[model samples]
Target: MDTDLLRTFLEVNKTRHFGRAATNLYLTQSAVSFRIRQLEIKLRTPVFTRKRGNLRLTSAGEKFVPYAENILQTWGRARQDVALTDSYQQQLTVGATSLIWEINNTNEWLEQVEAIQPEWALRTESLNRQQIPSALLEKQVDIVLTSEPPKLADLQQVRLTNFVVVLVSNEPEQNMNTIIGLPLVYLDWGTRFAVEHSRIPALQRAPILHSHGCQPALKFLINRGGVGFLPLSIAQPWIDSCKLYFVKNSPIIQNELFMVWLSSNEKYEDISVLIDVFSETQNTC
Candidate 1:
């Protein structure tokens, strides 16, 4: 059972054409055919139908599909664990929302925590809102840095900081007047931010640009001369320099950052130490 053979089988099964599969897998058609033949010989049965030009899995191959998938998945996780073993005593897989990592500077926060915990290996992931749940439930991520609490059972949320998002602009007038038709760069903070934002005035007239994360939205604002909601910490210096301004009477959405983790885990003792450090931090950031 070579994983490569299973992979080829899976790809061929997907494409239903040996040449297409070979193109996708970056191998020659002859090589792909040879691997499938080798697999059939090892399994003592043909795994695919060769009827005319139609390519499909045989009954035995159909039944073995799930098992092959699991084998590959488990092997992939094993490889990740093996790679982490040499450099780390114990790995803390932290999944952070892009807004937290890129905009709010969660990397600096992780460094502060890592300074105190020498024995723990910090592995950080910049995940979007949609990717966090499966990553946590599957144990690929041991900790979560998010603005909103996850609703899944067996998880506890530790409150970190409450921050405000204010409308900032790089327009020449640099005032509330620039908001209308300013090509608003909407960064997805969370559902709560969206709900809060709906009440703001002149937003209905805004030419919208949706961004997946904060950094790109901020960059677009600076480079293209638009108005959008940026974190207070992110927009402060520009606001001071007369390059950007707060929109008059714009809705200020307050969001809280949280560290979410499994409640029944032994790792919480070590994780609590990190949470405690966040709690003691100076709000200068």
Candidate 2:
């Protein structure tokens, strides 16, 4: 099976439109159509149905989607493993969202990795929560540390720790009533938090101020006294120091953190070592 063709099929399935998938894959629409046709011929079944401006998957396509994803993932992992073995110095790129960076425990994990696996060349990047999974898929990063588990079919997630997402405010008196009416500094990754906590009647009407990173959100929370959810691990020091206070106890937000990598990478020695260190650190946290 051609992994490239399977990728094209997956992209088309995701977008549900040939043109859009072509744009995403940087392929001509005709080329995209040809690939799908080739795939259908190989399988001897129709994969999609064309309706009024909508492309719906056939039963075969629905069943095949996960299998296609697994194939691509397996291929990618195999290629990466070969590349790593061929290189003289193994390079491991790790990615994390800003929220993970602010956690003191995560910093400790990095230190432990350096002490334990000093020979491996390590590079780290901070990306938005949404970008971490894609970064891993593209092989731009080797592992992603995230508060939310990735839902992609090909990815494998290793649970780290569960943490509370608390609403932090500079002004203690603001609390729920007054804070809910103010401009809340919402983190870009806070959408899940918002949805989970939206049922809190006070938050439904709050004016939102969006920030791309956690530092800016924390700054906004400090300067403007707006509500934002932050991990307990990161916010605990501030709370203990009386720098930030919880806004309301109503919508208690909590999420599990995961160290995610391609499942095939689990066999690589370098990745295995890092995973063990990360797992130990998370357990301690």
Task: Identify the candidate with maximal TM-score.
Answer: 1
Q: After superposition, how far is residue 193 of candidate 1 from its true place, in Å?
A: 0.5
Using alpha carbons, what is the TM-score of model 1? 0.69
Question: Cα RMSD for candidate 2?
Answer: 8.2
lDDT of 2 by residue, 41-98 (tens): 9999989997869799999999998688756655764665457643335666678887
Model 1 agreement with the true structure over 39-142: per-residue lDDT tens digits? 99998999999887998899999987767765775576567667775556676778887778865557666777678876677777767687677768767678
lDDT of 1 at 50: 89
Steric clash pairs (candidate 2): none
Clash number for model 1?
Answer: 0
Q: What TM-score would each prediction reach against the true structure?
A: 0.69, 0.60
Q: Hey, what RMSD does candidate 1 come out at?
A: 6.3
